[model samples]
Target: MEPAEMTSLRAALAESDFAKPPRINLRGEPIPDGLTTAVVYQGHEVVTDGSKPLRGLDRVIGGS
Candidate 1:
């Protein structure tokens, strides 16, 4: 992720009710499971292990 985008995401996460800091899973690292995950890549194809992006991220605010 770009620095500015990462910063914004961090700030937004901090102000939210996420129980833990978001994990940054990089290539060669084992991907986490059973949690909300966002796989960001520069391409039109998405190859998650069956994970999906959270629709309406606003709904996650305040731990809802």
Candidate 2:
């Protein structure tokens, strides 16, 4: 994705309340707070954590 698109997406996520931190785990159970292994991005190279449940928005806009 283009840098401009990434910036726009990041801004939109910041404005939306539904946008929460991402989670990274192999288990089916949810991960606890402050234990994120890394800041994963939904589409491109944005910073996201695993603080909230996964949603459609968490998925990449286009093919990754």
Candidate 3:
């Protein structure tokens, strides 16, 4: 992620209700059964595993 994008994301996350440390399981190691890439925002969990692709990233970063 770019520096400016990261900064924007940080700002947005700060306004959310239940933000957590985002994780990306892109490595080869075993990530447990249910572990996957995710972002928590406003008490909602958005997950992106192999079965589904991540979406609305631009919106997440305060972009159109």
Per-model TM-score versus the true fold: 0.32, 0.30, 0.34
Q: Tell me each candidate's RMSD, in Å, in order.
A: 11.2, 8.3, 8.3
- Model 1 over residues 1-64: C-alpha lDDT tens digits? 7898677666655454343323332344455663333533332222232233323333332234
Name the weakest run of 10 consecutive residues (lDDT summed) in model 3: 16-25
Please give, for residues 16-60, the per-residue lDDT of candidate 3 as tens digits.
432343344244555568455566665666554434333444245
Is 1 or 2 the stronger prediction by TM-score? 1
Query: Candidate 1 — what's its lDDT?
Result: 0.40
Better TM-score candidate (1, 3)? 3
Q: Across residues 10-34, which tens digit of lDDT does each residue of candidate 2 receive? A: 7655544333433332344555654
Task: Tell me the lDDT of model 1 at 19.
Answer: 39
Where does model 1 exceed 4 Å of error?
20-64
Q: State residue 56's C-alpha deviation in candidate 2, in Å.
A: 13
Residue 49's lDDT within candidate 3 is 47
Top of the candidates by lDDT: 3
The lDDT values for all models are 0.40, 0.44, 0.51
